[model samples]
Target: MKIRHLRNATALLTLGEHRLLIDPMLARPGSIPGFKFFGGGRRPNPLVPLPPDTFSWLEEVTGVLVTHPHPDHLDTAGIRWIREHGLPVWTSRLDAPGLGKRGLTVHSLEDGALGMGVERIPVRHGRGLLAWLLGRVSSYYLAHPDEPSVYITSDAVLTEDLLEAVERLQPDVIIAPAGSANFGVGGDILFSVDELVTLVRRAPGGVVLNHLEALDHCPTTREGLRERMKAEGLLEKVLIPADGEELHFARPERARGPAAPGPGATQERERASLASGM
Candidate 1:
């Protein structure tokens, strides 16, 4: 399996026969409004531009996986690109209808969809009112017969469910958002540095972190994360890639292990969604 770290929260994940583009935040620098809505020092979003090879790399995408529909994850440019490509989008039920409305070819990402060992783990974007406003987010675990198992923990604040998923899934690679985003008024919405330390310590294998130094709300710096990881003796397990830097991991040959089931999590989401009549 190859996980190319394209840019903040965006990745080109190649697993088995799939080249899934994860979270296509393809806007040019300063194209979108700032995200630090309540933050006093808010600046124009996407503090940097897509790396030079982004356009070319985008051509290889076979499908799309949206963890959430926030502008940073699926911006106007990203939406248009996927529409043009007519690629299938694998995502949680929450955002499927919305994305379909935007002309995307949507496929719900329930477990075992597409014949891949899949698990949809629900995540919280923030705590309290901010989380409520952000609504619910999703994390995904994909285990293709030809690649290592991966857990993509979309934008989330640490929660018991998340920790449980990590413990249960035992993913070979974990791709998480490290932006540490926060509207000035709320506490850290994304993972705080301490939380990331804990997350890395607990994960089974490598951790690829992004979503830093791009937007106004996300204050965590890559340098800072590196230092902390180094101090915690976790640098070897962490890959803090630059905008275009890519990391390649060998695909495991043994695909016999049963993937951790997320039926418990899915049932909870279904109940919640049904309760809301969504």
Candidate 2:
């Protein structure tokens, strides 16, 4: 599989025959309002523009995968582009109806949607009142038959549920936000640098970190994250790709073991357990 990191959480994920565009936040720099609500360093969002070759890369997108409806994930420009291309959009059950209402072909991302085993792992985007206000977000585990499995922990804070998912799914590649976002008052809305370090150490396979440097609220820099990871002896296991950088991963032989019982049974159980406070 090949992952081309674009600005923020946006990426061109090449999995088998599919070129899935993950979270297209296509907007000119400073087009959106600032996300930092309190302290200093407040500025319009999307601090940087897409790389010069971003359009060329976008042309290959076969579909769109949206983790949430937040403007940063799917902004006006992104929605316009998708409508123009008439691409099918895969989203969670909670978001499908809303997306459909917007006049796009929306499909719920369920098990076996695109010839891949899929699981939806719920994640908290923040904590306390801020988390509730942010609504629900989900991380996805996608296992293609002939490629390495990938778990996308979309914009979230560290949680036991998240750690449990990592332990159970054991994805070959983990894509997570590492910008350590904050509204300047509500603490962190995304993973802190320390949490990211622990996450990298816990993963059994490669980890890809994104959501850095492009936005106003995200304070973690690639250089800083690299430095921290190096200190922890975890740099080799993690990748902090720059915008427009592409990385490829071959499926490990170990990942080719027999299939699990049902497509998303493990995730279902996990979600149920969490719901029951188990």
Candidate 3:
């Protein structure tokens, strides 16, 4: 599989015959309001612009997978782009109705949607009232038959349940948000640096980190993350791509079998897990 990083939480993922855009935040610089409401450094979002030749990449997008409805994940510009292209927006069942109201072609991203094994893992966007206000967020484990399995841990803080999912799935690649985002008053809505170190150490295969150096509230920089990973001796399996950078992954050297259940278990177990996990 191939992934082309576009911006904060936005990227083009190629799995098998599909080119799916992931969590596209396509707004121009400073278009969105600042998220750091209580912080002194508050400013309009997207301090930087999308990389050149972004349209060229967009032209090939076959679909979209939106993990959540937050502005930074799927902004107005992104919605407009998807509408204009008339592409299918595959997202969690909870987000489908809201996105459909906005005139999108919504589809539930479940098992067999894209000829892949799918599991939607519920995530905590923040703590307490803030988390409740943020609503339900989902992280997905996708296992394509011909490609390496990937776990996209969209916009979440670390949890024991999440770690357990990682252990069970044993994905060949993990795409995680590394911004350590905060509103300057509450606890971080994304993983902290220490949590990231733990995550990298526990990963069974390669890791891809993003959601850095773009928005006003996301304070973790790529350089700082690299330094921390290096110190922890976890840099070897991690890839922190710059804007517009492309990455490729294959099956791991250790011959772990298919990430998902076999044919006999696919139907019942897949349905059971998705229902209970969410």
Q: Where is the poorest 10-residue window by lDDT in model 3?
A: 263-272
TM-score of each model, paired residue for residue: 0.91, 0.92, 0.91
Quote the lDDT for 63 in model 1: 91
Clashing pairs in 1: none
Best by lDDT: 2
lDDT of 1 at 18: 80
- Minimum summed lDDT over a 10-residue window in model 2 is located at 263-272
Clashing pairs in 3: none
Q: Model 3, 119-164: lDDT tens per residue?
A: 9999898788888988899999988877788899999989999999
Per-residue alpha-carbon lDDT of candidate 1 for residues 102-214, written as tens digits (9 for 90 to 100):
88889999867867888898899999998999998999988776567789999998888999998888888888889899888878889999999999998878888988888
lDDT per model vs. reference: 0.82, 0.86, 0.86
In the range 1-278, model 2's lDDT, one tens digit per residue, is: 88888889999998899999999999999999999988988899889988777877789999999999999999999999999999999999999999998888999998888888899999999999999999999899998887778899999999999999888887878999999999998789999999998898888777899999998899999999999999999988888887777777776654353234111111100111212221
Q: Residue 71: error of model 2 in Å?
A: 0.8
